[model samples]
Each structure stands twice: as structure tokens, then as C-alpha cells.
Target: MDSARPTPGLHEALAYLDSLRAGDLAPQADVPEDDEDASYDTLDALVDQQDAKPTLRPSPDEALTAIAIMRLCHAAESAGPDLLCPRPGLLSLLFVSSHEDRNRVARRHPDLWRRLSLPFPALMIEDPLGRVGAAKDFHARLAGRLLSGNGVLAIVSGMAQLPPELETLVTARATLPPITRRMLALILEYLHPGHDVDLPISENQLGKLAPVALAPVLAAETLDTALTQLRRLEDVARSPNGGPGLDDVYGQPEAVDALRQVVSDLDAWRAGTLPWREVTKSFLLTGPPGTGKTMLAEALARSAGITLVKTSYSDVQKAGHQGDALKALNAAAEQAKTGSPSVFFIDEIDSFYNRNQSSNGYILGMVNGLLTLIDALSATEGVVLVAATNDRARVDPAIVRPGRFDRHIRVGRPIRSGITAMLSAAVADVIPGPDLDRVSEQLVGLSGAEVTALLREARTAARKAGRDLALEDLQAAADRVQPQLGDALMRRIALHEAAHVVAGHAVGLPAATLARISPRGGEVVRPHLNAMTARDIKGMIAAVLAGREAEDIFFGDVTSGAGAGSNSDLAQATSLGIRAECAFAFGPSLSWISPDTPPTLLPTEVRNRVEARLQAGQEEARKIIVQHRGAVERIAAALLEHRELDGAALAGLLDGVEVQADGAVQHVGGHDA
Candidate 1:
């Protein structure tokens, strides 16, 4: 062989020499006589003895040396004479992990491993756990100790669990030193040939290791296609129609209108010479789950003819580290910026503002970082920032305060007519039976998403049983989709709501148009009158208490159903009673009191007086139920049979007796008239 060529035997000999010095070589029992001139002869005799003992299983150290030699030979053979020469004088110290997968891969495809490991002195590390802190410390110490060289210092492990500090160094951002950046760039080039050696190394490790990491990047014609194939890679999904346009959204005309107005303003701002600040681009959408808040965000973007960048709590958390999360957030914003006239929607805004989250450094840093990003996005012109949360109260006030999120729109559950429209829209494709109205009536309290979910379930059932979507299918789906409030609980709920309806009618309050007792909950959709006198308020309070009172009368005890926390009927009644006592001064007290007036300063007798009023209301409610026992029983029986009753049907059951606003009952005809 030419002296210029590094022969495999010479490479192996050098490897064995290094291993011998490092104590990785196996011990020999035969010792040659002490003589400096005969040392080569002794080494040859030791090699012959090892060859004779080839049956011996290799030790960890021996196996490692063999792996290195195999990689060298495979690299030479595969690359031929054009082997990519290592940058002259560069000593890329790679911290090779003895992780099981890493070892297995190195052994199985030594050639591939060698090609990737080129130009780096692979140092086998015993750390299998791949702790980021330890890795960072190791990298920092090694970089300092080995900075006299010109090559890359790498920690090669199969595990992709990188800490934020190391990630920053890899990206060449944050506080990473210039020398470290140069070293990282060389490593990156080793991994990807033709990568710019001079350009700054800002590429994240996750992206660089995409081909070998747990999840690899998949190229596709469109983002939607990629998402369809690899759901894990998707962050923002293209809306079917700019994310279910207002027409596609089931309900909440008020919210849709507000979004439309904002879009119109955005258009004017974009077209005319008006200041960008004049346009309303940020909104806080508060709603319960399944209420289409996310859909609305997409719709707003679509309505404005803009792209939607949708990110969520789970997405950010999936990124693993604070640096990774910030990268994701920055990528989302950058995508929106590049695709101008875009909407950046952050779903579950409360996740970032949750006080309940642990004060762990990572979580706090992530939330603060996200807040800064949101504020920055608000300053941008073309991107509208719409964030959604199930409850606005859960989010920190600072996040939703003026200037950050200036507009607030509530996407509440669909009311009666809204439910009708939603059900109609959902079933537009199916041929329904005459009982569509019945289905709509039964599905009063469902959200737009719930409505669609039920329709999908019902459609599936209908198709499976070889039938078109029908009322029976819808009802069956409801029974399956809705929570199964046991027969006993459902009966109690029916009686409770029926009692409220009866008490309302008896006390000159309008009866509910539709009354339901579902597994999820119960509701009596009574007439929504704005103005109320003290008597009307008292009647309302009585109606609220009648549910519990009815349970008490029938079962001798009340369920927690009546004592729901905070926002329950009991709470509402108490609030109204207190308001009447203080704010409205409709109580027995002669003096009018402001709502802000301290209750402690109020005469101590006011509390007693308020309790008395509530007690009287309950008593009045009980008396009405007792007087109209037959009507109450009839309504309850009808409710148990039908699960719900329309106003017209309920009116016929009560013989046309209708409550008037003037606290009087009048005999009326059919409810339709």
C-alpha cells in the first residue's frame, strides 16, 4: 500500500494501540522477557495468543473498539477514493452514548453510522438516560477543554431529549458563545452535506434529526395533505371553509356579527390610509366547550380572506422544553407574518394564564414567553390575534386586559331557535322524517358541536341499520351521546323541573315553552321578560325553590341538584334577594341602599329580613304546588313519558290557563293563537 494511504491494518493497529493505552485492551497471561529491543516481538506473540483464544466473548471495551474499526473500514469501502475528507485540523469530539438503540444501530449499519460520524472523535459515554443538564455540563466542559481545535464537539445519542440550554447552543442563539456556534455549524454540515459552513447555525436539532428521531418530517404537496397522512406533524390545519364560516357555524349570531364587523374594519384599514391601530384585530372569545369558539376564530380568518395559524396548549407542551415551545410559538407567528392577512388563533388561552399550573420554572417561563409573543403579535398589522377559552374568568385579567385583547365576544350555548337552526343545518344532507321538529325540541341545550356530533352518530347508526337518518336514529344517538342519568335521577329531575313550571304558572309567571330533564342537566325555558317588579322577582325566586321543594315533598329529602355551587338556582335566588334588599330597596326597609354599601354597616336585621323573604317565597311556591297538585302531576307524568314538552302541549295540559305580566292568570286558547 502507498505510504500516503491509511491501510485498514494500520488503522486497526492504531485503534488497538489507543485501546491498550486507555486500558480497553484485554489482559494477557503470557509475558515476554524484559527487553526494549524485543517489545515488538512480544506484541506479535500477544496478538497470536489472542487469535488462538478467539472463542472468548468480547468485553464492552473490546466490542467498542471493534465497532470503531468496523465503521472506519465500512466508510472507506462505501465512499471509495472520494471519501469526504474531514476538515483539516478539526477534532469534532462526539460524546457517543452507550444507549441500547445507539449501540444496536452502530453495530447493524456501521457504514451509515461511520458516514454520519465522520470527522468526529467518538467518545463513548456511559450516560444512557440522556439527561439534558448533564449533557449541557459535559458539552460546556468539553467545549472549553477542546477549544484549541477547529472541529465540532457533539453528543451523539439516539434519544432526542435536549435541554433548553443545549438547544440554544445548537441553534446558535441566546447566550451561546461564538466558538461554540462555529463548532455546531461543522457538526451540522457533517450531518447534512452542502449545508452552508459560513451561514449561522440556527436550525433546531429536532429538524436536523427529523430523519432519525422518533417522528420524522414528511414532505407533502400541501399542509392539509401532510396533516392527513401524519397527524402528529400538524400544528395548523386548513379550515374546510376558512374554518367553518359564519354560515357554517350553528349559532351565536351576535358573535358572528361582531367578528364580521371587525373583519370589515380590518378591510378598511388594509385598503384605505387609516391607521392600523384604528382596526379591531384582537378579540377574546369566551364560551363553553363545544360552542364553536375555535370554529369562530377560523371563520373570522376565512371571512377576512386570510390564513389561520391555530396553536393550542397540547401543541406547545408536546415540544418538550421551554426553548422548543418558544421555537414553536415563534414559528407560528412567523408563518402568520409570511402569510400576511392571517389570523393567529391560540386555543385554550387559559392554559397559558392558569393560576392552578405548578410554578415550575419551565411552565412559568413558557407562559411568560407566550404572553410576550401575544403582545408582539398584537402590534403586527396584518395578523389578527384571536384567543379562545372555555371560561374567561379562568384566564388572568392581565392577558385579556385592554390593548392585548381589546374585544370580548361571548359564544354561549344555543338557545331554542338557535338549536332549531343548528339541527336543521346539521341534517341538511339527510332525508328526515316528520319528527325532525321533535328531535330539534329534544336537543334544546346542546352546543353546536354537540349537535353535529349527535348528527354524525345518528347518521352512522342510520347507515349501519340500512336506513336513512330518522328521528328514531337521532333519539337513539341522544340516549348514547348524552350522559346516562339513571332512571331514578332522571325521574327526580323531571319532577323538579315540572314543579318549577307549575309554580311559575300558578304565581302568574309564564310557563316554559320547552321543559327538559336530561342526563347532562335540566332546564325550563320560560319566557324571557326583561323588566320585573318586586312581586315578579319574588315569583321567580319561588319558582327557583320549587324544584327542591318538590323533591322534598315527594322524597322527604332533597338532592344536591338544588344546591349546586355558585351559579345554581339557590345562588341566583340568594343574589336576587340580596339585590332586592340593598340595591332595589324593595325589602321592608324604608331606606334605599346602594349595592356597594357594606352589608356589615346595614342594620343587622337586614340579613334576617332577607331570609324571611326567601322563606316566604318558598312557602308561597309550596302552596301553589299543593293547590295545583293535579296539574303538577300531569306535567310531571307527561315529562317522564316524553322527556320534554313544548309550550303548546304544556298549555293544553293546564287547560289554557296562562300567566300574565300583571300578576294575574287568564284563560287562553291554543298557545299558537
Candidate 2:
């Protein structure tokens, strides 16, 4: 209703008007009247002659004037139509239409319209389903005639399906210049829906959006600025290598060397000065659990002044499609290329390279994808790959070849000195004494993780009681924990062990540590001899099993506790003795082909050989037991009385009670004498 309200097609109509005015050189034109006007007036008069005439009639001039007046009134009541005008050397508007009569001003200005170029330029028409077939035909005809130079033909439509020719034109390189920067910004905004336009787009953010486009831009930057920013981020992430140096990592000097080498290579590779002819871009860290593989990887990345992208196989496998998984991996790799050095850590890499026959092809495909990605990444500068695995043997051999993972570092259990230092560092606040030393000595074969668990237990015990951790707490914790081998097993183990010691002594092999059986921890049979012939080892094993078998044969039934025999004890003894004879080449009979070198021993053969040797040792062991039954009984009785006895107590009980080979005993000590 408002005259000031611009019609929907105002811009197009105005553009048309401007184009018409520019082309016409003539100035003005007056309104023309003729016989048609007179007829229209006459018809109007006739119609007025009778209010209800059989036929309606009006004077021609009057009728025409009335129609003109109605049109003018309608035009005045509604917002006037927009004028489409073209400006020379600028954009133009073509079509202008609206529902209002006021918008049809062009009909009154026929002369003006005739001179105007009708096909508009830089105007978009919504043509869903290409229904504007005639409109398009009209534009093509006009374009062939009056349209000059390069002009934008914008089409707005809900349906994006365009003719092949139009699509080709829209996407052509030459068409790019006519596309206004504003249009480009709009297209980008539309494509990336919901992205805040005003937010700062950093290298990190750009890398997230389209890493393919952003990675090269970042890589071209100066190294110092890139490294500094990355280091700052690392600090924020609280990464271990956030600081200037690598002094925080404990023990593992060899592992430290390997890490240093990796960092050095990564730096050189980034700087385009690597020395190795074919150095692997990736390193594999394999070891027992909790040996700091993950921590070391992070620290290595941090030290190189790179962002670390850690991913597990489980994360990739969850993506469903192999392509999707690879895309994720590649995206992560690209993200790390943000003008800085980056480490891409693939943890539990064995999962991706599982060599199990039952993996059903999925693993192979994953491995192939990873291999391709790794190869592509290796050729790239400023990116380092570090993979870790607990079971290195389970990984496919192809993944561990020379160039893929050139550096293989093994992290084993901590030795005695390492353990001691670890304890000193971890438990410095806790008071330690002879008990701690003794406990440490007993924990020789434990892995680093196990030792840490022990330490944690000790600390927890002390904390629960609201006191400083003491040696007693550690000792008590140790006592409560049983060894992998049980006590009854250990006694059979000890007698079996004592057999080894006795045989070793008889065979001129050095005696093992005094064979004292105790339930405190399993029978710890430490051979005093550093080395022995295969024959001597076999004799010792035979003796050990002989002791257990002798007790079984002589006593008819073995005891259940420590100092007797059980199924577990028999199994251990017999197995070891067989290994000594059949596997160790310690059997009495020697052949050109050593038993140790057998391709494979059938289970039946192994069982028969072990049984035969065990029976012989049992017979010999029974004779010895019979000769010293009194001394043996005395020791067993004393052990029952005290419920615990050291090596000295057992030795004292046997002192001066001489049992000769003739089975005669003479007491030479106080009570027995």
C-alpha cells in the first residue's frame, strides 16, 4: 500500500530503464489520441443512455479513458513497478515482473521499451526444473545479438541439475573472473555450513577444515616460528617434552639413545639434510607392558617440537569402512603438517598388522592402507611416525621390514641395579632397611611393572594406617604374596633341587646354593655353577626328579605340604629332567644326531623317555632315602615342631647322628647321643 515500497523486481526494472535511457538520443514524446478514443467515449455515452439496456454499450473515447484511469488508479494504489535499466560498462538487469498493475509502466512507454536491450545481464532467475524454457530461449537469442563482452548469467534454483553445456560454462576457468569475490565467499560459507565466518582461522583450524589445501601453506613457513608455536602448544598439552631438554626420563640408557637418534633423524629430515641413505621414517617400540613406550613416544614428539597425533587400532577399526579409516588416518597426518614437525604415534600397531591366520582378510587390508599412508608420509618433510607393540612377534613381517621400521628397540625387565635405583627413586620417602634389601634380592626375576605394583601396595598399606611407609610394611606385603610356585610344590621342588645339587657335586660340577627348602617363597634353586657339560646337567636333573620319585616309591603316599610331593611337583621335575636328557643332549647315550637338535619329538616318545629315566632315578633315590631315613625323619619332625626352620636348624638336627652305608646310626650330639 505504501508508494515508497519498492516492487520485488525493482532492481531489474530500474536497470532496464537506465539501459533504455542510455541508448535513446531523442529527448521527449507527447501522448497521442485518435478515432479509437472517440469510439470509446461514444460507447460510454450509449451505455449511460439506459441503466438496464438489453445490450451494454459505451462511447469509445470514454471507455478507453475509463480503462486508462482504472489502470492509473491501480498503479497509484499499489507500489509502482520496478524498472530494469542497463548501464554501459557496468552490470544490467533483464526481466522485471510483479503481481501489481503499477509495475507495468513499460506498456505505457512503448517507444522507450522498443529502444531498450531486453535481455538482462548479471540477473538470476529462479528456474526450478528448467521450466523457464522460453525465457532461456529468449535470452540465448538476445545473447547472440546485443550481449557484448563478459557478463555474469546468474541462475538461482532449488534444483541444481543443470544442462551439461551450462555446467561446463559455470565451471570453466575463464568464467572465474566474472564470479565476484562476494559470490565466492558465499559459496564457501554455504559449503561449510555453520562455520563462524568471523572466527580467526589459524593454521590449526585450516588444517582441520581442508588439510590438503592448508598443509603446504603451513609447510612453507620458517621453521623457528613454527617450532616455537608448537612447543607452546605442547606446554599447554602438558606433554613430557614440553620443556627444553629430555632429562626427566628415568633409567633405560639404551632406549634413551634410540629416542635421541629418532629425534635427530626427524630434525634432519625436516631440514632436508638427513644423512642415512635409506633411513626409515618410522620407529617401532616393542617391549613388555608398562615399560614407558607410550611416555617415551610422547616425549620424543615433544622434543622434536612437533604436535603428536596418537591413534589406536581400535579407533580405526570402529570406523566401519576401510576407506573411512584411512581417511581419518590421512587427515590426522596432514593436520600434523602445520608448519611444524609432528609425530604420529600408532599405538598397539600389532592390531593393524596381526599375522593370525584367522583374521579373515580385514587385517591385511588395514595393513595395506597403513603401508600406503606410511609411504606417502615418509616422503613428506616435518612428519615422524612412531609405532609401539607389546607382541612384536605377532606383527606381520612385512610391516617390520628394513625401510618401514628401521629402528627396533626392545624394552625388557629391569635388572637388579635398575630395580634398586627405581626403588631408591620411587620410595625415597619410605624408610628402607635390611628387609627392603632382602625383598629386592628376592624380586630379581620380576618385571618393572611388577616391582611398581609392589611399591604401590607398600605405600598404600602405610597410608591406610596413617603412618610413613616402613620396611615392615614392604616385608609384610611380600610375605602375604605367594610366589608363582606353591610351597608343597617347592618342597618337592627343593628335594628335586637338592638332587641337582648333590648330583652336580658328585659329577664334579660346582654345587648349587645350599638346597634349603622353605615355604616362604618357592624352592629357589640357584645353581652355584656358571656353566656345565650337557652330561653334568642331565645327571643333576636325573638326581632332582630321583629325589621326588624316591619319596613317592618309598613312602607309598606323598605328603601335601612343603617337604613332600604333589602332581605339580612331579610334572615340573619330570619335565625338567626330560628337557635335560632329550633337549639339552645330557642323556647317557650319545648319538651323532644330538637329541637337542631333533626336528621334533613325538609326545609319546617324550613321555616314555622321561618315565624310564625317572624310574631309574627313583630306584637309586629310594636306596639313599633308606640309608638316611633316621636323619630324614628327625629333620621332618623338627620342622613340624617349629612350623618353620632355616638351613641351620635342619643341619643341627642331623649333626652327630651318623647314618653309615650299612644302615647303622651312632649318636654323637647331646640329645640324640
The prediction achieving the highest TM-score against the true structure is 1
Best by lDDT: 1
Task: Give the per-residue lDDT digits (tens) of candidate 2, residues 1-673.
Answer: 1233333223333333333335432322222354221111223223232322222222222122222233322332232222133233222222111101111222223322333334333333322221224335534533432345444333221112234444333421100001111222222232234542332222222211211222221232333433344344434333433432333454455566777876667545433356324444577887767777787777776665457788878877676677667656655554454323467788898888554433456667788767766764554444567888887645776777657775776654444455566677766566564444556555544566666778799889999999988887776766665343454554453444343333333333332322333343223222223234544444444445545553564446555432344334455456555555565555553432322333245356555766776666556555555555555455444433333343355446546443323321221111100
lDDT of model 1, residue 427: 73
- Give the root-mean-square deviation of each candidate in angstroms: 19.1, 27.0
What are the clash counts of all predictions, listed in order?
A: 0, 37
Which stretches in model 2 have alpha-carbon errors above 4 Å? 1-251, 264-281, 302-305, 335-340, 353-359, 429-437, 480-673
In candidate 1, what residue range of length 10 has the lowest lDDT sum? Answer: 171-180
Determine the backbone clash count of candidate 1: 0
Query: How does model 2 fare in lDDT?
Result: 0.45
